[model samples]
Target: MAAGRSLPCDDEFLCAICLDVLCQPASTPCGHNYCKACITGYWDSRGLAHCPICKEVFAGRPQLQVNTKFRDMLEHFKSMRAAAAADEIPVGPGEVPCDICVGPKLKAQKTCLACLASYCEGHLEPHLRVAGLRKHKLSEPVSNLEDRVCGRHDKMLELFCEPDQVCICFMCLKDDHVAHQAVPLEQAHREKTAELRAATSGLKMMEKVKSSSVKDIKGSMQRSKVESDSDVSSINAFFSALAASLKCRQAELIQAIQEKQEAAEAEAAGRVAVLEQEVAGLRRRRSKMEQLLQTKDHLRLLRRWPSLQMPAHSEDLFAPEPERLSDNGPQFYAGIVRDAVARMEKAVNNEMELLFHEVRLSGSCEALKHATAAEDPIEDLIFRSMPKPEEHLRMIQRQHAVDVRMSKCDFSPGFVVSEDGTRLSFLEDVRFCLPEVPNGESQPPVVLATEGYSSGRFYYEVQVRGLDNFWVGVVNPAVSKKGRWILASYMNSWGCFDASHLKKLSLKRKPEKVGVFVDCDTREVCFYDVDAKTLIYSIAGCRFNGESLVDFFTRLMTSDDSNHRPKLYPVFSIFGSHSSSELVITPVSPGP
Candidate 1:
């Protein structure tokens, strides 16, 4: 072994205190070798001189002399090991470097718990070969080796205190944590690994659930696209049919005018032919009269004039009175055209409203317009304002009309109600810092008309022209405005927008004006589409059932009104967050 065989086996070229290939190796008086600074530091830090391994106390501090021969051997060993494993990768970011490597650190291969150091394959050779080091624990390379050491005891934390739920050194178990249940670090690691695996299993389950939800969402999207495409095609066909009808009607009108012109020309031609015949007769008579005048016979001229007769079917000539005929010609057709146009406009506007109603299913009015962009449409706003009388609504308006006015003090903040209570509008820029109303802290602004109905049938109309997320319902005056929000058409029913026991409804037309009629005797409420003359909805057998729940809450939030008669009042709700449209309580009038 070249006279250095004992060096590797006895670890003579290593430091006992620093536990690495010795730098400036020094010999102690006790026949041990250590790095010179390591020995001096050990003594200076302790203020005593002693062997760390053997614990042989000295009477006084001993001088540490450099072991030149041992240090030369260590340098030789280090250089030889470095040259042997020179092909290994150098340590890079995120990789633990060998603690004992002299120059650029090589990637660490193993860590030693006994030595508290990481080693590359070059420096790890002695640990593998030495019998004394074989018993030391070896692990995968890890950075921050000091974290595994106990802070207070300065020993390797090799155990876990179960009661304390912390990593502890063996000395800690013997001291402060002596009575605590303890487990070997490997056992605790195994248990923690099991827990991690369980958590991973739960995460995998959640991942699968999320994946399924994503798949469902994708399917819904596909179905919506299909439906949208179908609707677009249907709307295209409808407009094409409509345009065809208009074209056909145009042809009919033109043809009628052409026929009328042709007949009038024929009538004038007949009258002109008759007048020409009469002129030829008068010319012949004049020639005859001239000859008679030459014969000096006045009696003959008079006789000839008497024989001259008026043309047949001629109008009166003496006074020449103009015919008093009612000329039902082009003017008559003009009235017809005007009437046809009015009917066409009404029907077309109604169909256009149907498109907005389709938004609930399509989820977007803008998307629908884009989807049906193939038709160069009439401007959308023109159709939005069209309205005609509805039969049921008009009847209700005439027979059951009741005056409704909003209460200024009763309405929630962030809203402005008209002095007459006919108009309701929201504040656009600010959330109110005003006084609290009865509906304080309840989201959105609410307004209930001052008029309440407890008996008899009554109807009122609301002009919901530009409103969104608006609710026009009858609330029981007996309960707080919060309760008996009996009905609403809340923004296509998105997100908890529903009446109690509400079911989905499909409207063919979005009503611009709505009429709500209540019959207390029958216990029934009916909503009317004012323009379409259609019953939007009707809820029968309504029991306010308001009193049952109001008394259960704390007195601060409760109002004892269980025994009061449930008188329903008109309620207008505007979710100030989204709605900006104004509502109008319109005056109802009878249909002519």
Candidate 2:
């Protein structure tokens, strides 16, 4: 009975005497439980020891003892009750709490939309028992119960209004949503859930594709790094060999100098040995002569002079001077070194140029250029996966071509029209003047064809071989051909500029010819690269038929034209300083 506690208990756990939960519970012989105090008081008040539940009598005074096991069970129940009370969650502000609960309201488990009330488990038991309450609709507890019921009719909201996209009550079907497309709420929920699932599936597929692309890019980067490392290693080895050769050449040069010095020293030592021998003879003779002067060896001295005769002392007895080493040898070697270096330099320069050319030829340079030019990271990734420009063009063309003619009217002063009227050129001005109009706005060069189409499909080819900036497309009859700077800028016109500004139709190569196809019935306009047979860009869902023309004329407050149906004229705009550039409306090539 504690607040916020809804634990159920058996009747046996209650004291029969006090009609309350048991305390110090004890059992009688009749197997009925009672509080010890309550049982004892009942027996004493009756003046007899008897079981109150079964009417069993006890002869003499029965020995009363506390039931220890029952006391333990009562203590366990008390602990659990206290724990449950502590675990109870108090209702907070703005939460749907039990309406029937009085004191410290409990959080509601469910709400009955019919009764417009929320109930906690304790108070909700009545809904399960009472037949009337059971008939009420129940749903997860919500804060705004009134929103689930219609304000006008006071009925539960059960249907969905598809036209207005709102939840409607049952009464709405007979009232506001009677003519509207209404369906059961469950059907709408199912359809919306299915759509979400499909979108999720598509997202998952895209994630897989992006993940695979990332992996491929990483793998390519790793391979490129490996190739670069290998190239570095080869370059290092080449330089290392060159250094070793230089060192060997240096050692050879030093050895040649050492051999020359040894040869010169040996010749000088031989000459000096001959000179010393001559001096020895002269000394022997002089010694004998001195002995004779002393008279005791006069006979020996005279005999030695005749026999040896004095050694001839000539002025030619001189050592040969060693020649000064010349710088010629070293200079010759230096020349050889310089020539070797020059040859190596030339070879390296030529090899590097060849390698650079090879890289360019491999299309790596083009790929790198495009990657750098891309504005977005995702766009760059997609661009890398695209096929070659020629291949893409071929796929779009599908061999489609058409005959077209240049317009004569609205020609700017700088242009030259061909004699046949099939070609238009922005040739250098010779002697042309601009026509003065009432409006101050000067017209940029533009032209429109006389023929137009309001129904059926029509195709044409325009040769834009030398032009850099030009426009091509079909325009509404109301387009300002006199002073309009851009064709696509106007609401009734559709044009693609062959310039960087129009990224979708930016051409890598100056298309020699362009094919324009227009389907009036479908309101589709497509441009193709004629030579490459590639589709450039397309504008679909255009409004260019009879109805659109009528609307356009209506807005201008003008009557219908002489033609039964309004027609769209092929238009062109050209602006360039060079007169040589020409825009020729050429006929389609004959089919094979």
Candidate 3:
């Protein structure tokens, strides 16, 4: 039998049940061998049985024996395989063969100290027995032999230091390390042996921890990749759906625009066809009439009688009737052609006009007229006199009052209600006072006053006979009329009322009830209602004083005060300085 091959044994040595190897040898009466306890157990359990291998009858349990020879053979083979594997420098299971030494050689036995090269036993003879290489030390093959180097310089290391637990060169000990502790290579080897044993005790624990960490990191990366892929898929799906919807909307818009354009074109074409048809009919009728006039009968009559009797002028011939070829002979063709052309032109103009209705030719014309009318005084005056829109006027007044109060009073400008609660401060210089009673002696006054002014226009109004009687005048600086009176107020401070304050009153008949008075002297202006003698309102800001009274009065009479009514004076004066005079009340007769 081949040394490596497994051979079949005789039936007496073979196991009967497995048919290949006998686990424990047993003998039967028939001289056949079976596994110990195999045939005996079969027969003993059943009380009667034939031999499993030879069919020999076995009425009782068979004897059994251990197969020591077969067990020894198996152990020997395993030992040989393990020895052979150990002898070889076994690389990693799937590692590629070294390119330099492509074939198997005797196991690497020696390494060059200088070149750091490994050599098999066959190649190591020169380094061992040769006279020049006899001093080189040889070592058993180690997987990490390449890592041994001088501890300090990291060069090829031959010497080991037990004291430092390191490998070193002789140069290291002789140099800066001369005084340090040192030991022989043999002592270093013994120390390394103990260290290796200690390291090996915890090797399995380190490997397990390293393996767990690697598995955890790999699992985390795999999960992250999966989540990233899922996110990409979701985003792609969303954009695809959005793009599809946008495409649908774009198609819808295109269809709508196409339909609208088609309708517009169709309408335009229809109008053009109608105009062309009318023109064509006119041309055909003109051609027919011209052909009739050129006939032989008509020409001979015209040649024979130069002064032929013409038709009398009638509405059909003279009036501007619809142009037809027969009415005025050849001359009527021109009119017919003109009328047709005019109608066509008008139709085209109407179509164009409808197409551009938003275009304002009148606005352009007005702009041009305004640009050219810059020097026109009347236009300027008209523009100036045009009443501001009510909303705009209110806004301007509000802003003006805020700006004035913020500038003058040094107090934050805001609206405030009067103490009496009858008026609101609409602006810094303007107030709105509502009438307390509709038919009372006096309408409410919207007062306008400035601080520290002694003599100026004290303009106000009084209600008399259901009309406003406006007055403007100035009183003495000391607030007493008996003192030297000064001209102060005018209706509007034009140049004519600069020197003297004048008082002039006017009855406005259009509203049937208002009277205005302008006083250049004392700078007082007031308004009154004709049916009542009570003051309605006043404004006192006129700076004029010592001006010609008559001229000031003329200008004040002509001044425009359409928007503002007079501010009223309170019946009772509440001055802390003087309390001597009693309030005076006088009734005046109503004017006719």
- TM values, all candidates: 0.43, 0.34, 0.25
The residue-level lDDT of candidate 3 at 133 comes to 78
CA lDDT scores, all candidates in order? 0.71, 0.65, 0.44
lDDT, residue 84, model 1: 52
Clashing pairs in 2: 393-533, 393-534, 397-533, 426-579, 427-579, 428-579
Reference-based lDDT, residue 262, model 1: 83
Task: Encode model 1's per-residue lDDT on 191-216: one tens digit a residue.
Answer: 99999999999889867765665566
Candidate 1, residue 175: the lDDT equals 90
Compute the lDDT of residue 468 as modeled in candidate 1: 49
Q: Candidate 3 lDDT, tens digit per residue, 1-592? A: 0121232323534466767656655556786666666766777776777876566675555455655676565455556655544645533543322212345534455566654556654455567668877676655554454577765676666566545656677778886557767666677778778989889866766666556645654665576578668977997898799689868975885586567667767876777797698669657756765665667796665664533333354233355744332223335545675787697676556445433442322232333234335343554453343332232222212221110001122222333334432222333443223322212343223222222123212222222121122112222333222212221111221111112233332323312222333343345544443343333334344433333447556656888533222222222111111112111112223222
- Better candidate number, 1 or 3, judged by TM-score: 1
Question: Ranking by lDDT, best first?
Answer: 1, 2, 3
Candidate 2 residue runs with Cα over 4 Å from true position? 1-124, 131-137, 140-188, 211-322, 326-377, 381-592
Model 3 stretches astray by more than 4 angstroms: 1-180, 184-186, 194-210, 295-592
Candidate 2 residue-wise lDDT, 1-592, digit = tens: 2332455474757887899888877777666778888998998899998887788887765655677897787777778877876765568887778887778888888898778888887678878879998998788888877777788988777889999999998788888889999888889999989999999998898777667656666666676678779988997998899789878977886788678767766776776787589789768867876666677666676676665554355444454645654445657767887898797776566456546545544643343433245243655664465345444233223333334555665566667777677777666564223322313344345667767666656677788766655666776655343212122321112235321123233456556677777766555777777877767677665545324545755744776444544477777756532456567788765333
